[model samples]
Target: MIEVDCPSPAKPRVSITYCTQCQWLLRAGWMAQELLSTFRDELGEVALIPGTGGIFVIQCGADTIWDRTRDGGFPDVKTLKQRVRDRLAPERDLGHIDRP
Candidate 1:
């Protein structure tokens, strides 16, 4: 289950994930955060960001407003978001930081 903070029905609980790829972070008992950018992550294919702390806040609410419309059949959105969030988190947690 996803554990998060922020007690508010309107506000989303922040979810921080270590890294699924990084054995170290995963070993530390941290789960990767799922992400879905504002709209049109790129020119074509939907981009995915890393889920560490900053990516899209990134998505601590399990599924944010944008996620509600996301195609549930595809898990890539979450995976990609996590990847981007992890990399961009150092930059003051830029919300909706586009995936490279």
Candidate 2:
């Protein structure tokens, strides 16, 4: 659930791209909080104004794996949708990926 109070408005919606190197990159189930830590205030103008709904997105090793159910913490609907999409991604277009 989003916080009840925000320092400002303008909520930040995020989309994460795993580098295939971040060992932690595994599934969308745990992406939201991960994004909050990774993207943090770096969004600049799109900065999440400490609001009820800010910061979202995540993925796993393939840049698609979606599984926002952490056994305990469940991300919001928007976060879940993105994860599902990444999970259902096309397998052939992955030609751009390279080993780090």
Candidate 1 residues 1-100, lDDT tens each? 9985544354333443323343234322222322323222321222234444222222434534223124342234545444444443434344454435
Q: Pick the candidate with the highest TM-score.
A: 2
- Model 1: per-residue Cα lDDT at residue 33: 24
Q: With candidate 2 superimposed using the best TM-score fit, by how many Å does residue 71's alpha carbon deviate from the native?
A: 26
Clashes of 1: 15
lDDT measured at residue 87 in model 2 versus the true structure, 0 to 100: 42
lDDT of 2 at 86: 40
Local error of candidate 2 at residue 64 (angstroms): 13
Q: C-alpha displacement of 88 in model 2, angstroms?
A: 24
TM-score of each: 0.20, 0.24
Q: Taking the tens digit of each residue's C-alpha lDDT, what string does model 2 give over 1-100?
A: 7765542334334444333333334433255454454335432111211212222224333342332233234455454444433444423222223122
lDDT (Cα atoms) of all candidates against the true structure: 0.35, 0.36
lDDT assessment of candidate 2: 0.36
